[model samples]
Target chain A: MEAFVTLDAVAVPLPLPNIDTDQIIPARYLSRPREVNHADFLFHDARRVPATDEQNPEFPLNREAWREAKIIVAGKNFACGSSREAAVWALFDAGFRCAIAPSFGDIFRNNGTKNGLLPVVLPAEVVEDILAQLEASPGAHIHVDLPKQEVTAPDGSTHGFEIDPFAKHCMLNGLDDFGVTAAYEDDIAAFERRYGRENRI
Target chain B: MSEPSGPRTLFEKIWSRHRVTEREDGQTLLYVGRHLLHDGGATAFDVLRQRGLKPRAPDRIFATPDHYVSTAGRKLAEIEDPRHREMVEKLARNTAEHGIRMFGLGDPNQGIVHVMGPETGLSQPGLLIVCGDSHTSTHGAVGALAFGIGSTEVAHVLATQTLWQRKPKTMRITVDGTLGPQVTGKDVILAIIARIGAAGATGHVIEYAGSAIRGLSMEGRLTLCNMSIEAGGRAGMVAPDETTYAYLHGRPYAPQGAEWDQAVMHWRELPSDAGAVFDTEVSLDGSAIQPMVTWGNSPEDALPIDAAVPDPESAADAERRAQMRRMLDYMGLVPGTPLTDIAIDRVFIGSCTNSRIEDLRAAAAVADGRKVAEGVLAWVVPGSEPVKRQAEAEGLHEVFRRAGFEWREPGCSMCLGTNGDIARPGQRVASTSNRNFMGRQGPGARTHLLSPAMAAAAAVTGRFADVRRLVGG
Candidate 1:
């Protein structure tokens, strides 16, 4: 779980807005064992026809540019509905290191931060600029340097994204909920010893 | 950092008693007393298997299968989606493999997990409960500490009988006075959310107390807790009483004669001491609550059953005004349109939230002498096979069928668009289920959350209407 927090590539061209958990990974995949390869389940249904057995030929991911794209630029309200952590597991496992959106679902945002996924909130027009760059030059990448607190898309364009200070502090240090608690484990022990079992429900 | 607080709400009482200790960060390591299981638990089971672990407290675990499968007609084995069918079969097989107690498919004790917990007494006061489903908090009605967890956290509980959590602040909601006849527990919860606004209880656990809540049946209390998330609280709970004790007297998991005596003594001690404390206190009058309806994408976007859609211009808050305008446009509801004037294409009276035998009986009471509107596609699904069988024996199913409502299999059908039973886009559906979020039913579909009785009456009238009209007529 060690994290570099160093800037990697970024895809400025955002994906469609209001991306739902089901669209990230269909509900059918929810029944599978969590250890199963959930990454493959992402966009499984959207790639295929709703009523028919055929796959959509022009879906974005089907395009060559997105074959190995690790950074996803998405529209507003991404990761909305159902606090399924598998949604985060899928995006993280799929090699997506960062997601830039105007707005994000509360649960998904919290889960993303806890799981080491950096979520960058930027204005819509700023995101559209990156999309234009990606569209103009396929396979374009943006640098999202966590330590530097900056993002540089492939076209050498610079953008400043907002990250909650508390969350940023945790991700760069690879601290999970327990890891954070361990910092105060000594204080917790001292309190318990002093209070005896009165506090133990 | 403690709130300007005094006199613990039931939530504070449980939190202080359960608190192992607060760590340096905003995290708490409290002991979990019980963990309920359900059909949608296969993912957690898989995680446990991968880690070579089993449930640490076998006695504390409970399970049922009412999702991704069904029990009305020949639905036990007939599954349209192979994915859903396999999930149910796997859940049943794995529960057996784990040697954990299970109310599996066809078991009379089996039903919606939340519905059966209170009925059978598994959900008791002063206990901590967790499950793989978000609605698990519905068990908090017995003054228990209950909340949902991710599969990973579920695995942590299975392996160690505990979970790593950041304790939320406590909010005390005092609901006094008696409710109006039409203001059921569902209405009470809706009304609370409407007043508090959607995110009012963010980062908090709610303690519900008052004569109004105490008077609700175990089934109704579960309904109240089930929708706590709609208010952004981690969970909601009610203290135990004679009704709680009576509900748990003789059930499969409840303690045996001597053990039961000891357990009840402890459960009795679960209430807040005369002088405890809470972080925040909010009081409301239940008598003022009315049958309510959600008119927007979020649950908070609601009004009393008799009220008209609000005009955005009348909103004092800018964000609320924008949201109101958006809701009006999306729902195709004019600002001044009366809620009763809205037409509905479908009526669904079943889900984990509602659809218990009691819920069914309530709906049937409204459906007794009426027939479903010809244009309405109405369906009644019991929470479990046992509920369906019981309702059939009591002729509740017949009552619905006679009224032209289709009595279908038990899986989580329209509650989520999971099992292939979804309303078409643009159709308005009155659902006795949770979550009326956009596209929650199906793409472009509109959903109105209501009680089973309300759903039944709506089915007959082909619009959102009051159930008391049919019930009292």
Candidate 2:
């Protein structure tokens, strides 16, 4: 499950920090059962105003160029609250292949990686440069070389991406949560067989 | 004598012992020994009523409301917000409707769900517990296999008292050194996260060990256990030691006399042997940590008291660079700005993260004989009403009031924005609570996550400053 990993497609500048899980997928969405089409929720809170009919001023996704963004370039400490894995599920389910940030809260990082969402941390200057580049050329795609660990922008430029060796291992295998647990299947079974019923669990 | 190859790390002993049925795919259908309930949990009970399913074992389930209860509006009858009042009303009605033990609002036994659970003995050693709250892992310090479940899974536990879980791998983090003055369990966990980066412990159950952990009080251990989620781990724990036993003695739920002695004997045997090995081992020096603060959105994006905000240029990863710029813009923080010079408009001193009595005492020491800065909007919200009353009776509230801080009642309060308590847009707040991501306090507000003492100092200074400096330096 371990290998060199890199992805560079489009630089989607979210340009916001402290984007919480509630904003990513509002709590009311949780009241509803899981569904395949949760992408509308990406900016439900942002798009609440009435003038949003034509302008859609209320949704974060309403930003024209960012509507189909698969790569998110965001501010420091993204996803700092809540332990909801659904936040990541919604992002991945929405079409985010990779998310570049200065930092992510502990639970968000784990949840993002657990679901195969790549979170790349770089120096703030380098991230800004990418944001500037995206502004210069909207809909630009970059080439991410996982083996080389670099992201090559639309202008034929490149930048390095750092990921923990372990997380990289999980993403490359496409294992996510189920994959990690399967590794110790034999021991888990043996333990349960010996102590299962009498435990009155 | 047994070979010392694998003496069974506490994580292994607990994880291996809890499995009931394992599918070939590796997920386990494990029976839950206990389920600690919180306000967020009443929704599950409501679902059960709608479905007409009775909980399989009422004795194993426990309920308390910490998230939605109003700290200021204690009397349920006085709550003006219909939604907030209805939530509390639902909590009371739901607990009784389900036959679950109810720690209704204003009950002496009522407090933060995690705080009251262990204090009351329902969260004992060797048991597996689950709650809808992430901090449910706090019970692991007592040697229990506890973790948080989602709402749907919360419903499953409510009905069948079981969870389908995939076992986590093991991570052993040992900090073997003396903690410096003013450093705390909070500092230790923050330091670990900063040192390893946020994803260092993902997909693993971390067992905290060595001198630093052993030296912690039971409450300190719980504080450390509480931040396991912040460390990207499924859970964190320390084996029950003498401190654990001492804290558990004479509590309403703990075993007494002969039963207590027997329980102690079993608890004493909880530690791993000298030669025990783990799948992974990480070590740290405790002395290196200082009173820490999260400078960026992530818990790992932290630095010591006197440091410059991270320059985006120093970010080595492409994704990192992009995110750094966004965070700085939202926070209105300029790169190269000295963290010490960053002024705060508000200082909030409460949350499940740092609202306990010990936390209050620590903050009070900073507020004693001092007053908040002219423009700082400060608050002292205790974790529970009992804590608030206890502080008031002890004059801790006076210390806070003397410091020009608003000494408020119990409830989640401003830690979350749901209670109509939030900072206005563009307000910079030094918070003693956890999760300082942009706008976490309210729309357009910037938060700097700090220790409680640090929050007090910030209140007095109206800027990020060291609490130790106020005393002498």
Which is the leading candidate under TM-score? 1
Q: Per-residue lDDT tens digits of candidate 2, residues B189-233? A: 888888866556656788899898899877667777877776666
Model 2: CA > 4 A from native? A1-23, A26-41, A44-60, A63-81, A85-201, B1-5, B46-51
Name the candidate that leads on lDDT: 1
Residue A115 in model 1: shift from native, Å?
A: 3.3
Task: Report, in order, each candidate's fnat.
Answer: 0.16, 0.05
Compared with the true structure, what per-residue lDDT tens digits does model 1 show for residues B160-266?
56555666778878899988776777888888887885556656788888889899987788888888877767788888888877777776666678777777787
Candidate 1 ranges beyond 4 A from true positions:
A1-29, A32-81, A93-110, A118-201, B1-8, B16-22, B71-76, B311-330
B39 Cα displacement, candidate 1 (Å) = 2.9
The DockQ for candidate 1, computed on C-alphas, is 0.19
